[model samples]
Target: MATLAPQAPWAMRLVTDRRPIGPPSYAAVTLDASTQRARYTDTAGQVVKMGEHGTNQTNPTTSMSGGGDGAEPQPQTADDSTPDYSSD
Candidate 1:
C-alpha cells in the first residue's frame, strides 16, 4: 500500500483587482489535488470563494531591468595614496 503525501500550503494576498485594492491581509493557500483548484484561508479562519468576476494573476508593478530594488551597491575602491601625517 502507498500513502499519499501531504500538500504544502503557500502564502497569497487576495485582491479585488489588478490594483490590489481590498483587505490588507495575506492568506495561506492550498491547491486541491483532485480539482486542481486553489483554496485560500485567511488568518481569521474565513474561506474566500471565487467571485463571479473570476481571478487573474496580476503582474508586478515594479520592473527588474537592472535587478530592481535588491541590487547590490557597488563597493568603492580605497585610494592608494599614503597617509600625509607630516604636518609642518
Candidate 2:
C-alpha cells in the first residue's frame, strides 16, 4: 500500500484590468513676478487669482554667530596654499 504526503502552502494571485476611464483632465498654476501674486487655472481655462506680500513685504535678515571657539587665521604665502600639478 502507498502512503499520502503533506500538502504544499497556498499563495494568492493578483488580478489586473485594462480599460480607459474617461477624458484626461489637467490642472495648472502660474506665478506672476510683476505683481508678486499667484494664479491658479482649472481644466476648462477658468482662472482663480490670489495676491501675496499683503503686509509682510520685506524679508527679515537673520544673524548667525560663529561657534564658541575663536576664528581661524588666514595664510600668507603660496606654499601655504594647496599644491597644484599638471597631469598629462
Candidate 3:
C-alpha cells in the first residue's frame, strides 16, 4: 500500500483492472507523475494505462530544526569493559 502523497490520509493500491470487479478496498489507484495518467500492471507484466488522473500537489517541507540552547542534552554512553582496580 502507498500514500497518494506525503502525509495524505487516502491510501491506494495497484490493480490490473480499474473497473470494480467486486468490493473495492482501495480508495484510489496509483498514477503516473509525468503523464498524469492512471497506471497499472497487466497479467503479462506490462503496464496498462487508463484515463487521466490527478492528485493534490503538496510541497513537503524538508527543513529540520537546528540544535539550540533550549534543546535537551544528549545522553552520553560510558564504557564498562574495563574493571575498576582502585578499590583493590
Candidate 4:
C-alpha cells in the first residue's frame, strides 16, 4: 500500500485597501491565505478588514531589474591607474 501526500492549500488573497501617501503610487495591502486571514491596520493602528481581497499572483519574476540607463558598468582595465588596492 502507498501513502498519498497531503494536498496544498489555496493561495492567499492580495487585498488593496487604499492608495499610498508617498511617491511611487503604491497601495496599502494585505495577503490573507485560504487557511489563514489577515487584518489591515488603519492610520491609528487599528486592525480592520475594509477592502475586498482576491487571489492573484502579481509579479512572476523575483529578480531585480538592471537599473540606471540599462547598461552594465564597464570593467576597469589594467592600464587604468585609478588605484590597485589589491596589493595592499
- Give the Cα lDDT of each candidate: 0.56, 0.53, 0.51, 0.48
lDDT of 3 at 58: 46
Q: Estimate each model's TM-score.
A: 0.29, 0.24, 0.20, 0.19
Query: What are the per-residue Cα lDDT tens digits for candidate 1 across 22-78?
Result: 874547788879999877778876877654544444433332233334568654443
Selected candidate, larger TM-score, 1 vs 2: 1
Q: Compared with the true structure, what per-residue lDDT tens digits does model 2 show for residues 1-88?
A: 9997865544423434578688434377777789876657777777755444354334334443344344864443322233344333
Could you give the candidate ranking by TM-score, starting with the highest?
Answer: 1, 2, 3, 4
- Candidate 2 lDDT at 73 equals 44
Positional deviation of residue 11's Cα in model 3 after best superposition, in angstroms: 37
State the local distance difference test value for candidate 1: 0.56
> By lDDT, highest first, what's the ranking?
1, 2, 3, 4
The pairs that clash in candidate 4 are none
Which regions in candidate 4 have their CA more than 4 angstroms from the true location?
1-35, 53-88
User: Which one wins on lDDT?
Assistant: 1
Report the Cα lDDT for residue 65, model 1.
30
- Poorest lDDT segment (10 consecutive residues) of candidate 3: 79-88
Pitting candidate 3 against candidate 4, the one with the higher TM-score is: 3
Candidate 2 residue spans exceeding 4 A from truth: 1-26, 49-88
Model 1 steric clash total: 0
